[model samples]
Target: MTTADYIALALFLALWALYSWLTAGSGSRFFPRLSLNRAMAERRRNWIYNSLRRDLKMIDTQILAGLQNGTAFFASTSIFAIGGCFALLGSTDKVEDVFSNLPFVYYGGRTAFELKVAGLTVLFGYSFFKFGWAYRLFNYCTILFGALPMMHDTNADRAKAEIAADQVIQMNTIAAGHFNAGLRALFLSIGYLGWFAGPYMFMAMTAIVVFVLTRRQYFSDARLALMDPVSDTKDKQERDMRT
Candidate 1:
């Protein structure tokens, strides 16, 4: 490919790395606010601790099932995406011809096209592994949840019960982290598709994707919804009074 294409790809990867770092809590020292993922991780810990208080944990089991099912779904999707990339590679000659004929398209020739497809396949494969491992971790978390002491046992020795709950919380949070990693790869793949057009388009699309992800992580309505209810209500009332 050209120097511009290489530079664009490097920028795309750098932005992806930076965004992942920020969302993974590396930016906590610089910012007081929590990212959506971090906020949900706290909720997961609370849910696990709360489960220790209940004898019948059918709801907790169901939540674990849901997490496993969602991870499985994304893992399967990643596999399908990998297959699609291979299929595209198979038809690259025709696709290259079409791309070359398209106005404003860079069409970096056959080798470049194949290289792009190969990169996409690797990305999907990586995501599939992340999701697959996350699913297994969720399964382990479910078993750990079941092993947690009943309310009476917890009353007898709250410290021991809390330790067990903490184990489950850690497992669940690790699974969620891997699941988020897979999901992030899938989102970045959208920007990767822009590389088919040109390097400039690729960088632009990557920037746009990163901006959207940053907003959701640090400033979206979903993040706000997860904030403490009392504080949220107070802030809302003050704003309303001012208006």
Candidate 2:
């Protein structure tokens, strides 16, 4: 409820937006690297396209089931988190007393504390909706995947098969995007907890969280592992030229 508090909240929101923009694949020139999300999206397309070439699709359905189950689990967790936030609000007096006694803690009275709890509730609610929608989209994607032409039909009409496969790929990608958004909110909530301590700690924690996430997206070993080897690509190009 202070000027510093307002500024810290603004910075927190700005950093969240910035991270989203960078990871959504628009900051490639500045980053000069492919993100893990984008790499996995490519893999999703490959997976869908590969299904068009196969007859037995039990494995593909299993993968879809796994994706749906994961999204459902996160959705359920968000609901639980929202309930916990409400419970926290109900016990504000006890928490406020604890905060007052703690060294280096900020107790901004009942109203401010309530507002902070409200914000946390909103974050969890947003995540819940995202995960819920992702779960639905994944279900729809499974239906689309099932509708894809069989191997013989695909061979007869490859163009139609490609179009059908592209549909499945797009649906799967969109579902994944929602799921990632939900996960990001959950991660950022950790930084938000610093606000309960003080605005300065809030800003520092938000910066630290963003730094870690950005590093993971651009520089982590997982990203490096996903990258296609330069030598392999060059060799493939040379082989194509010779052929």
Candidate 3:
């Protein structure tokens, strides 16, 4: 591969590693600290006293059920994606040959090359579809959060209910994070396939995409609002006082 391609590949790997490091922690790091145990405990206590005093057991059951469902969905989708990537290795040569021929192609005498291309294409298609659907499901979870019943009874002690709600939200957020991580893995696998052309180009494109995703997650307004320490601390303090 050319020098440019090598440079790109190096950059991509570096950025990917960096992004992983930056997002590794849920507290004192990353944009969202909502899952920090102390914060969650405070919210749970407030919710319990304010809205779930009578139905605490029921709320706990529902929260556990939601967590199980979300975790299962993510795990199944990720397994499918990994299987698809492994299947593609069997088709690499066919893909390489096809690309080599370019605009007008002839398989010549290479049956193995043809088979490899077909396999890689199928695998890539499966990965793309799985990743796309997982993303849609994650978006649906966000909508589910919005649809949760809001407590309107000012005099009702709702500490338990609030805690249940917080747990549900936290579980959903964790599921969404996992879904994104799966997508990242799929894309990285695809980029690795590009290494057949040469490691340099593979690294370059990977780096560029990684940089874009990191910037969006860390610098975007959505991330800022969620991660804002001042606001988050205030909310935690108020909830603690109420509890």
Candidate 4:
């Protein structure tokens, strides 16, 4: 492979490694404070409590269930997209040949490149849509949480309601996690297209993509907020206590 191809490959691999590291959880000492379990638990509990208490006004349990279902549908779609990528990989040569046969072919025997580009484009489009929708759902869940008052009468039977809310929030967070994972897979798969250059170049490019993703996960505010629930819950508690 040419030096340029090797450089591209190296960059990709580096990015992948970085992505992995940044997204890694509290299991590692470096990210010990980045755990989101507690916040997610509280959110779920609140959802259930609100449902039981009938505090959600026009928003019923059925609607909440529907929201969950919608997210599931998106996740399923992403899975199909991944399958499509694999299928494209298997039919790479045929895809290139078909495209080459087009009257407008201009790149001169670069049909494989065209196919690779198309595959990556599709994958990225799928990932972006999935992740974007997941983010919106998460925001919706947060708004639902905001609608319910944190304070409950000590004698009120709110345990079940709290549990339900918590469950919903946890599920939403899990959905977000799945969406992020889908994006990661898409990015890695795109990097895999580097195999057209050479095996070593492919490996290097994969690494670079890994590194880029990791850095974003580690340093991005969105990641910090999503992963560290304790701080968020604490803030909520403080607000409730003050009121």
Best by TM-score: 1
Candidate 3, number of clashes:
30
lDDT of 3 by residue, 100-212 (tens): 76654323234434433344455445445545555555455445444344454322545644654565455445554554555565556556555444445456556666666
* Cα TM-score per model: 0.95, 0.93, 0.46, 0.46
Question: What tens-digit string does per-residue lDDT give for candidate 4 at 1-243?
Answer: 346555654666566555555454524566544433333444555545545554434565465556556656655666676566667667767866775566533322455464555656565566657666775676577565555444463126456446545655665666556566555767687567656555565666676766565545444444445543464675445445545
For model 1, residues 1-243, the per-residue Cα lDDT tens digits are 999889988998899899888888997887756799999999998999888878999999999999999999999999999999999988988897799889988888999989988988988998999999999999999889889998999999999999999999999999999999999999999999999998999999999999999989977777776778576675355445545
Candidate that beats the other on TM-score, 1 or 3, i.e. the better one:
1
lDDT of 1: 0.90
Consecutive 10-residue window with the lowest summed lDDT within model 1: 234-243
Cα lDDT, model 3, residue 165: 57
What lDDT would candidate 2 get against the real structure? 0.91
Clash pairs detected, candidate 2: none
Worst 10 residues of 2 by lDDT: 231-240
Error of 3 at 102 (Å): 2.9
Q: List the candidate 1 regions with Cα displacement exceeding 4 Å.
A: 229-243
Q: Each candidate's lDDT (Cα)?
A: 0.90, 0.91, 0.51, 0.57
Count backbone overlaps in model 1: 0
Stretches of candidate 3 above 4 Å error?
A: 1-10, 25-54, 57-64, 103-184, 190-200, 225-243
